[model samples]
Target: MAKYKIKINPKNLPVFDKYWHYQKSVQSPDIDVKFFRKAYKEIFDKHAVLLREDFCGTFKLCCEWVKLRERHEAIGLDLDPEPLAYGKENYYPKLNSKEKDRLVTSEQNVLTAKLKKPSDVTVAVNFSYFIFKERQVLKEYFQNVYDNLGDQGLFLLDIFGGSDIFDLPEEETEFEDENFSYYWDQEDYNPILNHGLFHIHFKRKGEKKRKNVFNYDWRVWSIAEVRDILTEVGFAETRCYWEGTDKDGEGDGEFKPSEKGEAHCESFVAYVAGIKK
Candidate 1:
């Protein structure tokens, strides 16, 4: 009797395209559209006529912001040219003539980027500002936003936390019809240094998962710390909004005002708003 060997064959495996997988695995412009509209109206009691999106990758929000109203105009700023190009090719072409004229983007640093005047609202989402670890540096960024705001303007940022972030890996919510899965890889955590390293990975159902598609070096800043810095940087009022959980004890994607927070398991998302004086 001959011994049989089991072989892993590449020809039989599903081919996962990097860019295609990323495009299909992530993105929900409608959610940002809803959040931006609600957030803008919350601050101004009316739809914001102008918006500035800092550190905008692909600028899905900016495109949606412009489509919300005829008078609405949006400026998206990002350092990388790749996502900018992707937005131009994929998202921009999908816009109408009027919306196209209303939406404009530039490749630049968030610190130096400025709008015509202080916009009605300026947003920094995706926790991109975590790159600034130092308090003073973060304050400087917020102060710039304070200086660039129109009267009664608001600066919005989203933050994530939970005890589980100390040193652990987590999976992202899976979307139907998408053939990939996302992973948040937390490699190390330093309580003293407040340093954390994270990576984004993707897995296709029938293929081996791809690792480290994107990596980040960020400091997990607390809400208190962020609020303190925002106030010190010249914001008149800083408010934190806690996310609401459904009966299943999962986030419902709706965030409401809450100054006080309760301790939860390994994860949470919150919004921090700073009112420009």
Candidate 2:
């Protein structure tokens, strides 16, 4: 056997930033803030000033919310310190003084944290609430949200489902311009319990793929079940906003309040708003 040595260049090495990659692939906080404002206005015929983000990993949405308007204020609550610290270091410095004054992040659990003032709008997006695998636990969390909201508050949640959600195969998406790829890997699913294990992987150009950069152990809850739980938690009314499809049958990213949803699609994403009167 011939002996061989490989030369490694530090300058050429890629910086594998999991949070940066996750933000690129998963989050659209700017657009989401606008949507939240529009949805709140449409439902209540008034602009919302305060937003509470639950399970707010990295709290990017809270930072964006304050920047959306002069009067807007936001609070982000999450139990995890790692993402909170990331937000403080990466996203916090980008905000203006006024925006910084309006935005706050707390290391607190959504199920038990107490808010000094009730929020006009609260969101648990990115399906973060799916972490609660049991129906009772989910309901308890919803009740907590209900209790933390103002008299005319709105609770918004994003959900995804379809025929192919269960037993979903690992899917890879390439960002050619960014020179990286993102992978959604579904490790396992239990149909009876609707519980699933999922992971996110990333691969930089000319580098080996990074496995399990992020992982999720969640119970897939249906829109109907979520609505029922909201009702049980004392929300006066619940509404579904279904996404519109493009000419090619892909999601067009325009969501509208819909009485009915397309059921035959292999995958779908929608929002459910719970109104507290």
Candidate 3:
């Protein structure tokens, strides 16, 4: 019998697109939009139509929001042009003509942008507001949101913390099916200031690890502090949604409004809703 060998083509291999990988590993925009809509309805007993996404890096949630309802509209505000452009190139094309018409993006600072219309709901997720380390600055941003919302509007924000988050220097998640791994690196943390430096790294199969693809310098604000600030910013009411644990003692991804949260959780994620009356 003759010996035979198989040949491989470079074009057949998957291209390394960092944004694609980041979305797959970090974001669940489809679910997030549903949560936002549900939370709004639960509080106000009416459907929300317009949403504003702040620090919306690619605005994936905005795209998902419009897809949820024919009447829905979304405006994404971000200071960085790079991600905004990427979203236009990649995510925008996926929408139909009508859906495309309902979505908008602006390369402007969330703090200073003049919104022409009031939003039914506004969101700052992924702890993006943590970039505002100062209490007064964050309050100013919250006040901006409060002012931009329509009557009975809602503002939602996601926050994360736990004992393990501070102690863990780095954590890696492998996507075996995708042939890549994602890393969350905690480079430094200041106890006195409550400031932390974090980075996201990715490694494709058979490739060397890429470091610091995304960097975040943040002040880790507690849930109580965030609620207090929301109250200070003139939100009529503030609510907390705590994540439930699964049978395996891991986060189950279901967040329900709760007055008290688990005190001894090693790592946890939750949302804060500020409502304007």
Candidate 4:
């Protein structure tokens, strides 16, 4: 693994933020906020005014949520202070006075953090919850979420699985406009435990690849397993929102309620929503 380096030369005049690049390449906070707001209304027959973003890196979703409605408020929780500080410095400055006041972030663990008030919606997206590899611990975390949600609150999670992720040990994606390439490196996997060790690497043009910018040791849970856990944790019902396929048979970015999923064609992403009674 190469160490991170900055080209300290007059020739390289532009400054860059790797986190910004990561968000642009992989995250769609705008779309996420839209879906959450709309889904809440459709599911509960009422608008959701409060959202709690678990494992919210950079709290981008929190920033977006406050922007959706003046009455909306958001809280973001993460154990790391680095990204939280980054959000305070970069993303927070972009918010107006009202939005800034509505968005709050805390450096705390998801399992034990105390919210000022119960949340109307709790979201753990991007497979961040996979860090809890143990079934008991994952259920405990879900239970904590359930305990903190208001009546009829929803819990949302995004998950991915398919033949492609299992077959490939490593995959690379290039973003020409961003001038960087991202790599997903699977170092090892245990079939017996369904555990995997993975790392994220990045390389800018004309520079050495920076390895292990982010690493995850995750236990990939199936949809059925997750739904069962949510149910056990006191969610009255659960539903899956499967992504639609485009002409090329790739995910088209539109997700809708599904009882059955599309055929497993190498890879897929889906959202699971747990509704509180």
**Collision pairs in model 2:** none
| Candidate 4 all-Cα RMSD | 3.3
Candidate 1 runs further than 4 Å off: 1-27, 172-176
Identify the runs in model 4 with alpha carbons over 4 angstroms from their true place: 1-16
Q: Which consecutive 10 residues in model 4 have the weakest lDDT in total?
A: 1-10
Give the 10-residue window scoring lowest on summed lDDT in candidate 2: 1-10
The TM-score measured for candidate 3 stands at 0.94
lDDT of 1 by residue, 1-277 (tens): 1222223468875355444455555555567666767876876687777888898877878998888778988889889887777678667889999999988898888887767766878888878899999987888888888888888788889898989887576667464477557777888888897889888888777767778888889999998999999889788888887888899988888888897776655788888988875
lDDT of 4 by residue, 223-243 (tens): 889999999999999999999
Question: lDDT of all predictions, in order shown?
Answer: 0.79, 0.91, 0.91, 0.88
lDDT of 1: 0.79
Q: Write the per-residue lDDT of candidate 3 for residues 1-277, one digit (tens) a residue.
A: 1212223469775456778888988999999999999999989999999999999988899999999999999999999887887788778889999999999998888888778899999999889999999999999899999999999899999999988766856999999998899999998888899999999999999999999999999999999999999999899999999998889988899999999887788888899999998
TM-score of every prediction relative to native: 0.88, 0.95, 0.94, 0.93
Greater TM-score among 2 and 4 belongs to 2
**Candidate structures ordered by TM-score, highest first:** 2, 3, 4, 1
Q: Which residue pairs in candidate 4 have backbone atoms (N, alpha carbon, C) closer than 3 angstroms, thus clashing?
A: none
